[model samples]
Target chain A: MVEHMGAQFLLSMTTGIFIGGAAGYLGSLMLSKRMALVAGPLGHLTLPGIALALLYGFNVSLGAFPFVILGIILIWLFEIRTKLPMEALTAIVFSSGVAVAFLFLPIEQAETALVGDISRVNLWEAFVSVIVTSIVFLVLKKMYSGMVLISISEDLAKSEGMDVRKYNLIYLVLIAIIVALGVKMVGGLLTAALVAIPAAAARNISTKLAHYSFGATIIGAMSSFIGILFAEISKFSAGPLIILTNTGIFLISLVFKNRGRR
Target chain B: MTNDFVLKVKNLTVRIDSQNIIENLSFQVKSGDVITILGPNGAGKTVLFRTLLGLLPHEGEIEWKSGIKLGYVPQRLPFIKDIPLSVNDFFKLKKSSERETKEILDSVGFRENLKKKKIGDLSSGQFQRILIAWALIRNPHVLLFDEPTTGIDISGEETVYSLLARLKQERNLTMLLITHDLSVVYKFSTDVICLNKHLVCYGPPRKVLTMESLRQLFGEEVKFYQHRHG
Candidate 1:
């Protein structure tokens, strides 16, 4: 444990835990929908926004927000117009975002954008993220069954009175918000892993979706807490450590599943 | 619209990718009609169903009776057997009441014990019944089933057939079923629509399913064993 629980450290930690948990829960839906790799490219789509944030010396999420939203909207539009698969559309935006980001990104500031510095979080940012996380959690919980119903059968979902395209656009926007907040905890390159791995672990042992969904949140929060704490103690890069911690939890979950099966 | 009409499609045309999948297709259905649609692969049966459901934009009129609940069993088999949802969780995606879930499950002959079983672990037969159950729980006035040839219980259709018949008998549901199976039409369909981009024929299956119609809808070598239907 750290000798001192400084206020700055606590604020960053709280925001990290909340974002990690929400991302993990969102990832459960992504995994079930068979779009697990979506978050990775969406992370890459955040680069242009993060670069602008770094250039302007503002909160990184504020800059990342608009760009991620633009990318998601474009992906949605192209998905309808071209009828291309979502992964292909996301890959298209990912490349464009990265290429655009590098046009004016300073070499010295590149590392911070690529590998985030959570300690840069301010009290106001932390508070905003907390509120956003709670609202996302509740709204997602309401939409959870409806969204999963769409994945099960779009026709069925439509018959149930869901507007599939509208729900999908809204779903993408929610994902954008989470991805924007995620950049500060694990940076653009590793944010997908942060979202995906915990959900994967939770699925291993869960029979019901409620278990899988809630379990992912807990595992996600645990990984962020342990990873960030250890990083602070060891002076290591938090992003890589957080991902490694997520992987460890996934492996343990595999073992737990095997044990339960036997 | 007729007083007891369940559905009416007038000059319906659906264009996708700048190509017309369905063109000037028209049909009407009564309250208790079981209309079976048959055609070879690439026929617009599925497209017609989607157009009627208002999922796809169409340049014609499709109408359902006001305040009628619709349940659709999609054509493509759901590859959900590997996902982490229990059967009960799958039902919970729509209905939340324990009593309703149990009632729906039992109506389809689904064992109560299997409620906790992962949907991914159920046999295709069980899953198919579950899909039927999922649709039936809504007490829909009509059911649309897109029946593909494979990925369901290929060894037998007895359970599913009986379950569907029983449910329809009890509820007096209007049905629109799309299938490639001729025996299904012989056994259960009140009316059959033969389609291949245009309406080939539409009437009682006995008169409408002549060999000439089959060859026209399918290809020159088309044949079927109508007597084997049971």
Candidate 2:
């Protein structure tokens, strides 16, 4: 039964499943850590990665890596050198990335930046995104306690002998890879939703944050699979169609959450 | 002839932004000494505790006699909006074994049924007991508590002190207790330090809480409490 989908869709599904799963897992951890909102700007911030790669003759993901590394370093340095929190650092670095991308990328690529084409996405791109995202998430899952502790109290996290700054820096670099891959698949505009919506929707209902993450993966995959179907049927752009499905789910979750309170 | 010092703070200075929280502070807590630091709010009692644990960044040396592990109980807050952690899970963070966790919780008079309850469901006093259990699990050489009895019941309060007193004697643990409660001040502590921004007095409780010093420290409030207690 599993083999019937053939290697193409099967591999694409593997790419989609794990990438969606990994994003959902890390996204939920970030949500519980209260860094869910940071994903938004960080996603947008990767635009320069694509643009710079085009200009400098490098892979978009590789180009994005340095910028994301810079962003993470800047946040840690700012916290150590100054005292700004991670959220504030994300905003600052994100804006800087957008500015640099705007300044450098040709105006012709602006439309490309706005609409990510998952349909045209090739095997190599999917393979790289899936592999990198999986490895990063695998590492992060092991350090779950350390990450959660940092979210609870930075001082306590440090006293526990886990460098909170280092953990955050690691999270940022992975986030950059995800954002870089997201630019081609979902486009920069909706990439943050790809990280945030699944997690947020799960959080509205689950008791444990871990459970919420699992739920997020299911939700993300379903959104992508169904959105892909709807886009194929309606002949709409896959990126926008996928995001709209996610948004619809988000709104429904919001209503259900409010009703649960009453 | 002496246990010397289990914990020592030498000329500790902490400046957050421009304001000084711990200003040129120096103190020593010997082995088995239960020291209570009395201070009003904003007097930096919490700051002092945080500094000792190497939590908050500070200047100057916090030299500890080797093998001096610390157990801390932070100020409690209402249940976090949503994050799942059972009491057992919380205690495990302190490196306590299941058997030790059960014994410590029982020592603090928590019901056996509550070992599985989520931290969010426990009441204030029950939660504080759980915190105490966490601290005890570390079997720390020094126990630093900031207002440990704030939300406890009267019996729980008595139990806490008796348990602390017992732990100090049995384990020879040194304790640094920061609290505003005067009733237990003389009863539980061997040394009392009157702190208001700086160390105003440090000696045996009777000498430190003299009427003259009371009037000097808190003005009229001390007189009122003294009269009420007397």
Candidate 3:
């Protein structure tokens, strides 16, 4: 039994690291663009997709795919139709989305926590997450130049004849997709923490934008892997432990950075 | 004179937050025409530059016919410094030839060694020169500068103006320079526009900058100084 638990821990740790790395990349891109708050909303709103998929007898993650797309469309429409800033729109979507998920909750939800709950993510799930994370990272890397240009000044970008609107919407959708895929291992509540904390910590230390991206990815993987190990030893929830580790790193980085400045 | 005009603004008026910063301001800049836009600190010079670039909300038509692209040197260099952009990366943004970047930097009196250096690490004067080089890399047909010499020291200001003179001579580029530098105005400017939220004077340096006209533009506090050199 001890050996079996150890094997399960190793698999979870490996899966957690790859998914965390992808979250870090997404978060880094958002931070560079000064839009770090979008992560939480995107992550939470992913639940409706998972729930609806389960209701239809589909794979929970697969059901999440279309709902993620729908969420992106809704966000885009809100952006165009409403005067609200992106942050406020995301918050509204997240709260309403979570509330809607509660509506569909069956009495037995207390037992299963939703149909076919992903309490213990297996090797196949982990493998799929790793592949998805790699693809997301590669696509973002290729568009780094255009992304940087947009981040600095939209006016400059427009004068250069870049399609600023398309890039922004596409980027938002990409972020949503990444969050949707990462929902199972880290769960919705803590998934965005993996993205935001590592990137925020990296931002405090990195002088260059590119360096921040690289540093965030490294820090994210380390925290997730270490947190998994700690959870195994302490018999605590892996998700919360991973989040606490990231939060610790963030606070520590902030303290040291401020002191050095003084 | 026909060959000198690089930029032409017609009936230009810019509104910000319901306040009109520039009103019906019109002017022409010929090739190698070093035009100075002089006004008080808050007199809408920067707004006019941004307006002309179609960056800010404005009411006006600005035409640049030199077939020359514009290279902008913004007033605030501090904003650029906060980014971790290397000089090499700045050049890469324009996607210009390496030879062109080297030549432009050389003309601005900046060393090649600084290319790999981050923007924040450069000294004020060094950073200013690099910015000018960034503008020049576009091979601008007309150069639009918004108080390029604002925060620099005397020597740095002199270096920037001298570089402007050199570039103007070499490329016959039309330069629309905005400044509050009274000392160098007569010496460098071929034409000058005196503005106080509206166009008060726009013509040759000697004609538009007369004592009487200066008084009307700057009010009772206006002080006139005869150019010892020009």
Which model scores highest in DockQ?
A: 1
Predicted candidate 2 versus true structure: per-residue lDDT over B44-146, tens digit per residue? 8888888887777888889889966887766654323344556765665555688888888887777667877766667766777677667667577788877
Give candidate 2's iRMS in Å, 1 decimal: 3.2
Which model scores highest in TM-score?
1
Q: Report, for every candidate in turn, its global Cα lDDT versus the true structure.
A: 0.83, 0.71, 0.72
Query: Quick one: best lDDT, which candidate?
Result: 1
Rank all candidate structures by their lDDT, best first, as comma-separated numbers.
1, 3, 2
Error of 2 at A258 (Å): 6.5
Count of backbone clashes, every candidate in sequence = 1, 0, 8
- Docking quality of model 3: it rates as acceptable
So what's the TM-score on candidate 3? 0.78
Arrange candidates, best TM-score first. 1, 2, 3
Clashing pairs in 1: B81-B120
Better TM-score candidate (1, 3): 1
Q: Which window of ten consecutive residues has the lowest lDDT sum in model 3 chain B?
A: B221-230
lDDT of 1 by residue, B1-230 (tens): 56999988888888988998877888899999889999888788888877777788889788889998888777654546445899899888886578889988988887789899988777777777888888888698999988856777765466677677888999899999987778878788999998888889999999898888988987843744433342
Pairs clashing within candidate 2: none
Off by over 4 Å in 3: A1-15, A44-119, A122-128, A207-210, A248-262, B1-5, B13-23, B40-44, B54-61, B77-83, B96-104, B123-125, B148-155, B170-172, B195-198, B211-230
Point out the higher-scoring one by lDDT: 1 or 3.
1
